[model samples]
Target chain A: MHLEEFAEGNSFIHKLDPRVKFLTVIPSVFAIAAMKTIAAPIAALIVCLILVILSRLDLKKLIIRLITVNVFIFFLWIFLPFSYPGEAFFQIGNLIATKEGLLHVLSITLKSNAIVLLTIVILGTSEVFSLSHALIHLKLPRKLVLLFFFFYRYITVMHDEYVKMKKAILIRCFKPKSNLHTYKTYAYLIGMLIIRSFERSQRIYNAMLCRGFKNNFPIISHFELKKIDIAFGIAMIIIFFSLIAVFENTFTQVPIWIYQKTLALVGQASRLS
Target chain B: MHISEGVLSPAVLIAGALLTAGGVAIGLKKMDYNKIPGVAVLSSTFFVASLIHIPVGPVSSHLILNGLVGILLGWMAFPSILVALFLQALLFQFGGLTTLGVNTLIMSAPAVIAFYLFSYLIKRGNNIITIVAGFLSGAVGVGLAGLFMGLSLLGTGEEFVNIVKLVIAAHIPVMLIEGLITAFCVVFLKRVKPEIVGA
Candidate 1:
């Protein structure tokens, strides 16, 4: 369903040379991941926010799309600290939770959020083709690149087929009453999907043979890097390093709720003293 | 179970990337280009498989048939899973670039082992054997992935074994279903599209 909605365009982010953006993303991801303290990620999060702004995407749509996936990951992030063991900050009722565990959970949450946000920034603005070329340039094997190319090309077709299958099942009022029944239905669906895809692959191979059967897929020939690409690359590196250098050690003020709790704790401690 | 970029240490991520690259090179060296489309189709199947969620009580879990891919594609599953994981990371944010190698290895290793061990079981027309292998392969793959993921948490400054238990426990049901599904899927392929199953 998501694949069908992917729109091709000449937007600015999409227009920037793919290599520059691709290279930029790696460092940004690395820097975001390497931050032992929260400040770097909060800053990286700000950068992601700025990129999102610059991309001119509809804010509501992007948030909805991201939140849909983040909801699942957030579940794990929220539960990890409580279930995990570490030094306790304090106790509530019978539970002994630690500030250390909370910090670890918060870091995981922030880091994952930063990565997702950066992905949205990168993919939301760039064309899939550019990314593929960047991968090829980055020295991924040719077959791997081609595999991605053809896979994306046919994924929309497979997705449509899946939708039709699901709709047909719905139309037939097919519903499984038990876990076993559901599992059977799903297994059968997977079987059918595989059979269908294999058949399509045969056709694709045949078509490739008919035109000019060669091992190598034809490479797209139109992506030449220019001055803009170089400038963007340079600018990205400078900004990323500058942020890391300036704020690498600063304490990230946790979100307002945590800050309030911490402040309250500090107040209580001072009173005790 | 894709670990995102910020989830791993730089040392581990870079080391994983290099190690995965080496594995990919070893895999590719023996592969023929003619088999590339088959790998692509299987990779696409993996992508689509992830989208198919079967509800388990209140929440639903999806099947990731990395084992099935491994059984069918052999070593090529590495690059195939790598590509699919990368795209999933980029498109759906299912995983991150930094942890791509680790995640790829996490899912692919079990599949490779499954292929070697289970390829023989496909004979004798024993559906049970096929099914059992599928189940074990899927379970083992995810189980191993969870274990390594838990181990990776050591660098994150967190408890290890408990995280392992949590991840492994959560995936148990899906692993069972994935095993059966892969088994039957293989049988079905053997019935109609035997060639695709590499029979």
Candidate 2:
């Protein structure tokens, strides 16, 4: 339910330094994106799934995460295969699904699933505050890190405010319809929310200043990278890149070979004719 | 709209990240230290805005009041949107970490543009004109965002024309609804707290 619910586990992933997780996950995501063939991303997805299992995450939550991600990917499938122009794999009436398009969809699905699973397995194991700290340790801008912290802290508060406002409006017999009244009411609701937040922020700022708050958000916790953390980081990098490289070499060569074979067939046919 | 990971090429990703970094640097420099809390509050509002759905015909789409944020915060929309988007990606996977740069730029750049183009009108115009300006700001914000989304997808080998058509067509209702919402909000704010408009 809570974002940090799974973060408190004693799994090896939970104990790894957040900085190492951040560093490794980012590059792995990039490597997954850079992969040109389906096999690499499939491998990446399997690896991420294994990581998720090893992290001891609940099956229900994992399934929920996958469902949310797949909803978006489902839309991609609906549009991408029909729109991408290439060798036709199938046709229905006027719509044509291209070989290239289907391949593109497959690649995107695999890569996205892998990246999403990796993020949940890696970043989900650390508290939000610790993640910000890790970002700070990684030399990210202080302002950016503070922004993340404050945004995370206040998002729920703002959402609660919106909910209360909506409840009050609904109690007034306001039903949402597609018309001017609905739009105007919704706008005022949002306007009030913003104004309230603005005033609350002023008060909060004064309170913070009174408490001797400076621009910098101080982190009381320190992170130390253990030998296993370093080893895991290195191993992740190697596994991610080598999967890409291996598949890239094999897949890239196949296309060229197919092109040459087609060329040879064309030459023989022309000579015979 | 947020672009998911693995949807863009490395070239576009790097270019987007560099551009967003530059914008964020400027935004941070321009932000007042005392105003950081206000920015944070606005960032949270932006974060929750996506959950506020508005009914438009048969289907409903969520509000993305980037124009309002832009008009109020100016260049600070960059950092505000970045924070909200980062959290969205982290919490719900609505977007992806790898595509954060492109997603942030796609949403915030139009917002900043709306700020520059409409801030004066909203601040100085008569009541009706101010409303119209706000409407245009919101509509243009969504329109340009769709345009930018289409542009970002250009390098991905999709047909440029189809991408443009699809993006714009899907967002037509969103543009209209956001325009009305923005207009009403501007009118209300003008009546109650005009100074927040930063006119």
Candidate 3:
């Protein structure tokens, strides 16, 4: 399905080791997730935007990705503004938007976007195989690592098989609708996929056995831990700290100022209604 | 449907992560080397199936299939779902790292529950009993997942009361559809490949 579009690029971020990206991006995401203040997430968002541009992601595609990632935040918008208990920010019809509620949603929106962008730039740009390999180095159990490797390897194979079966159903003039028949059709299709996969697994196991498969997979290649990878990793750690440390005072001020300015314009327009 | 990153509190995130870590540990420990290929391929199938969007009246929703996954893999559903979710994040960006622990627990813990509750029942029951067990397992898997998601979000603040209610309510259609499909799928499995489910 041509997934992992960013993995094909060779930007500086892409050139960094997958293990290094994992080490840095994961903790950075946690730091972003844990940040309480509004300004902190704004700062994190700006840093992530810059990193995404440096990683050479397409602007249009990035926007599309952000919109897709905003589904949960969208739900927050629906309920938070009117439901939170705080000083009223504004009013529309019968509902009053709480200042605290709007502010909280804003911070969450920024934090969510920033974390996703950072992940796309850092881990998303690297080959997934390398990331799986990095898991081995990160001291995950060997079986778990091998399981991930094989799981990733077979998803596309199973997807292709699924597509073919769907086509066969289509040839039979099968029309899907909101009915039990449609649900049953899909159920049988999924059941067939499972059965096929089981048979496929048996063949795969036999093939491995014929090749003298051992309990452990032999590592033939290793990722060279380059100096630049470490330097870049440290740089990201510093950026992660600034998400909270540098924004301590602007913590409560800047975001309110920023939102108040925009909402002020909206407030003016709304009063005329 | 997984929770987006940054919405969950650190306490909820940490507790979820620790619990999931234990589950994955036990899951990995129990897995035999020979079963790796079987578990991997089956996990992949579930991954692909989850990507399929089926129409439910006016709207469409993707299949979750954690119920089916649980029925098949038992405790192994822990590691299986963990890997599948990790891949989903990398491939489709449906989820990310920070929420991985909570999301995995939300999906797989229910799956394990479904496994233990229905695996033996489906294997031994009559046709009607097997169907009922399958339906119950599928619905319960999704129902429990929704409850866990609400619980984790509740950890953020009580202000999330409305959202929590909405999340659980939103899963109703999914639960019913999951139940029906899993029931039919189980019937098909028993008829076509009894050994696969019987074992």
Candidate 4:
């Protein structure tokens, strides 16, 4: 959502150096990305939840946003297993869906939710400007940095323009006649936006030239990686690797929750026997 | 479409990564410094283009315009797409961090092909045909990617066939919308600043 939400937190996670935070998020994301099973995603979810609490943000809002995306993904997961052939577990009515299908969907949902949660925690805690500065200090090329700056600068302007355009449409009592009409409306809107943005860009470029704008954009960073930040970075990496190595079984195995459900079913069968 | 890490083979990932690096290096070497402003403008066009939605049944889909990127930036589209995909993975989590290479290749290969095809049309002085070809090239590029994705999944087993079918079915409407979007954007640019497509 907004970066202002995570600003001025006293949490230890927030106090970590920007570079450490940046480095940690990337590898952590990569590790989570590598997980293929439902179990690892659920574990990652738990770990992400813990990190959210550690970061001291509004867990309620974070969760609500997370659930929104999950809801969108729910349909995707629902059809995947049925479409993806696996060892069929059982039948639902006339439909056959495999245990593997359900597990696959669950893994996708878990992985996605974890990734979103991680991003919120990182971006939420770190100041946007500070994060950009850290990116530059990390020796991300100046061009890339400038591109991001322009992207950030214009995204908001674009949003505001979209809002104004929506307001204009409302004022005009413009309602679409059908899906086709709606599309035409959208195409027209985009065309108009591009034209406007193009004209504005020209003005901006000319203004820059008049002011003697250089080929490069400038950013200033004042963050110093103190001992505490180093310790935080080391601790996080060590724990991450340890989780990867010794905990691989727990990470990659079927989820504990699912295992418990299966065991419950088995226990009932044994009693019947 | 964005490819998640777990979906791809490790070998594919490493190979895609190496190829992506090479493509970026080559793109950088040939990029014209004078065109920086124009490239920046096109990048913004791309960034905003994804925001415009086209209705496909109950769900809406957006354009990728990998073809337009190629037409505008040629081989340079590789680096441009790379940067966008990287930022997307980070900011929006659209693609996986480790699978960036695979995703880039999947999306950009079509762009490369489209660039050459459209460039041929431009030389013939057929501007409308060039624009339409650019649009169709982008749509087909995405379709090709979908087929490849399906094929990749097919290797996993029979169940993946259904998944692939659903994905392809879903993308039909998206492809159409993407084509129209690319055409409109190109035409508008053609009128407002013909120089963009003139090269």
Candidate 5:
């Protein structure tokens, strides 16, 4: 849950305006998702890897994050290959894995990994508060931005409160069993947590009011887009569109060539018979 | 039930985002200034609620508690769920940025439904009826969320029947567990702090 662990870096990727990075990364993700051919996602994945390297993210942490994202994709591969109907590429006993199914899995895997990597390289290098500020700069609603700020500030505090409650339960020798007692205990635990958090919220509200709190979040830092950020944005758009064009042409031509070859074989067989 | 990026078509994503934006706007408008801290606190609780594993018979499931949020916050559930989901995506990558709209809709829409269906019963009923209403709200909230999650996956070319059956089947245990949790919370609040329950 340590999302901003990499935000302290002085790397080039870290130095770019959060808004520029956000704009660039979101479109690239959309492009990857919209891609019809596997090649585009593969190309996107490579681009993301290059960005990750440039960002100088810790290799171990990056791998752990990648694994978490890929685990769901791994489950998709297990089910989708058998469920999607297409040319059977292989069979084991009764189950058949189709070519289209495998391609589906590959596409999702590549697209998801590419996006996750880009997110880690781009948004991961910026603080959440700065990102919220950038969103505000982009004309996102004031209320939504404030929500993000409060959510970010108190997520850890609430987590610690839950942990403390869990510890208290454990201290009383609460063993988790497959019985009603365990369920009720957990229910009560959650109930207690909710109640405590609510009471704390009232106190927090009172404290904020005492300090002349307003609905507006005071902005401290301003983002200025540098020349490198503009260059990065242009490069992303160019690579994105070129990959789309190249892959779309290649994928479109491939099916037509296969259809023609099949027709030729069918014609030849009929003539010989 | 978080849908990863690239799983949904562009049209679905855009539609989900637009609907969610509207929901959040309504939620913000309805929220009082004094209640912002409460919403923030609940939002943070929700962000961590997913990490709290509840033991259900032989298996353990994480708490979503959207029903609790719904019954307590009403229209504010939209913005509350949005912030919680945003943090979840940022911190754990539970859902992707591209699919945030879809995920928010899948989770919070059901919560709003639960509020309308059961919040009145919890407010006006006796203790036993209140608990039952709370349980039903929690279970239905989860069931509707599962249905919505399945619907969102329709763009993947899967049959609606099969996806719904699968999603609901996976969530059955969660529904029961959350029901018990929500019921207990409701009952406890009624006894000790009845005013906060808005009863």
Candidate 6:
């Protein structure tokens, strides 16, 4: 029910240009992903945490979101320590936890949290519609942007229809058990939803034709970059670029002479595992 | 399931982004202006449908009907899924920005594969064949997606080999459920609105 809850704020982040937010957040996320050590992601995570706190988002909602994101991480933790073969960090009755595995999972955890938080703080702080508009400004295909706009516009309508259908079925004592009946019911529900959408699109298309429909959907508004927006963009670019620089032997920048050395290291490491 | 951001190595991320861009380009090229509303609304419907949670015990799992999307839209499932995921990221934060390309590829590539593999049967075949094709499409959609997600995870290191297997194993139930649901859905569509199945 609380769509774009993070976007509805008077904070400085909310006021920043969506274009800048898009341009900066993407590279920063990739940078966080590429970090080889935990320290860098921890730093990035701390920065994002501060930004989110400053943005005045509802902590309850943010906590829920973070918990959902961590579910995947939680799964990683379960099998990784016992399954990854390496120097033993600890021992259970028959289970062995590897030092390398724990470190790797920890790094993944930090980087994942940092990247998700950064994305929420930056791109998520703007209305999704505005972000679509910004995608056009960022040189994404206009057709894709228009599609995104139209998709978001109709999603709520379809959801309302879905809720109504669910209510009707619930009133009919439709209990969703793990059975053929439940599956069939859901299939019917989806089938009905699709049929309605297809039918409604016909009317929508006809209405547009009546209103002088064209192939192109043109925007009435364009983005105007402000000084503050540019300044924030530059600051973020530097921060993220520096984060990317922290990896001394990351994939993209391995020196040619050290290539064989790194390859040898990889071979040795593989042997260890 | 959407692989969260920052989990994949850059190599996998870049590969996913490139493939997704190529798929989206083909989809856009095939799509004309008039079909925009139809594609948008259809994808929106799928987006809403994904929220339906069926009880699997004490826990419930939401639907991932990429097979249905692929059958409905064919190649256009690419852009449709891309937009849906972007909305999910923006609205629910189910996935994040960095992993957008990878997640989109994970879901939609299988969708495209399912379309090619099963759409023909669903269109031209009789009731039993249609149901069988629908089941295959649904199962293949999630099955291939689970495989692709595992491969993407493997890009991080061989350490994730166990996780990769687990990820694929975990999807078996969903695949079965999706197969059944999709089979019935296709049958229903064939009965109620035959042309809407793919026309």
Task: Give all candidates' CA lDDT scores.
Answer: 0.72, 0.86, 0.89, 0.66, 0.82, 0.86
Q: Which residue pairs in model 6 clash with each other?
A: none
Over 4 Å off in model 3, which ranges?
Answer: A216-220, A248-273
Candidate 4: C-alpha RMSD to true structure equals: 8.7
Clashes of each: 0, 0, 0, 2, 0, 0
Q: Which parts of model 4 are misplaced by more than 4 Å?
A: A1-10, A36-40, A71-76, A83-87, A93-95, A162-185, A202-206, A209-220, A249-273, B4-12, B30-37, B57-59, B119-124, B127-131, B148-159
Instruction: By DockQ, rank the candidates, best first.
Output: 6, 3, 2, 5, 1, 4
Candidate 6, which CAPRI tier? medium
Q: Tens digit of lDDT per residue, candidate 3, span B1-199? A: 8999888899999999999998999888889999999999999999899888898989998899898888988889999999988876775567779888889999999999999999999999999999999999989999999999999988888889999999999999999999999999999999999887864
**A129-236, model 3: which lDDT tens digit per residue?**
889889888988889988998998898899999999999999999988989999999999999999999999999999999999886667787889899999999988
Among all candidates shown, the one with the greatest DockQ:
6
Alpha-carbon deviation at B29 in model 6, angstroms: 1.0
TM-score of each: 0.86, 0.92, 0.93, 0.80, 0.91, 0.94
Per-residue lDDT of candidate 1, residues A1-273 (tens digit): 565222344456657777777888888777777776667667777887887777666677667767766764565554565656768776767666667667766776677787777776766466677678777878777877888877777777777777778888878887744377677677767778878887888888888889996756467576788887788778767776677777763234436668899999999999999
For model 2, the superposed segments whose C-alpha errors exceed 4 Å read A250-273, B159-164
Best-fitting candidate, scored by lDDT: 3
TM-score of chain A of 3: 0.88
The weakest ten consecutive residues by lDDT in model 1 chain A span A2-11
Q: What is the TM-score of chain B in candidate 1?
A: 0.89
Residue A240, candidate 5: Cα error in Å is 2.2
Give candidate 5 regions above 4 Å deviation: A1-3, A249-273, B159-164
Please list all clashing residue pairs in model 3, or write none if there are none: none
Q: Over the stretch A1-273, how does candidate 5's per-residue lDDT look in tens digits?
A: 455777778899988998897788778777877776798889988888888888888888889888988876776777778777789999989989889989987888888888778777888888888888888888887777777788778878888888888899899999887676876787677667677778998998898888888877666667787899999988987887678878767557769999999999999999999
Q: What is the DockQ of candidate 6?
A: 0.78
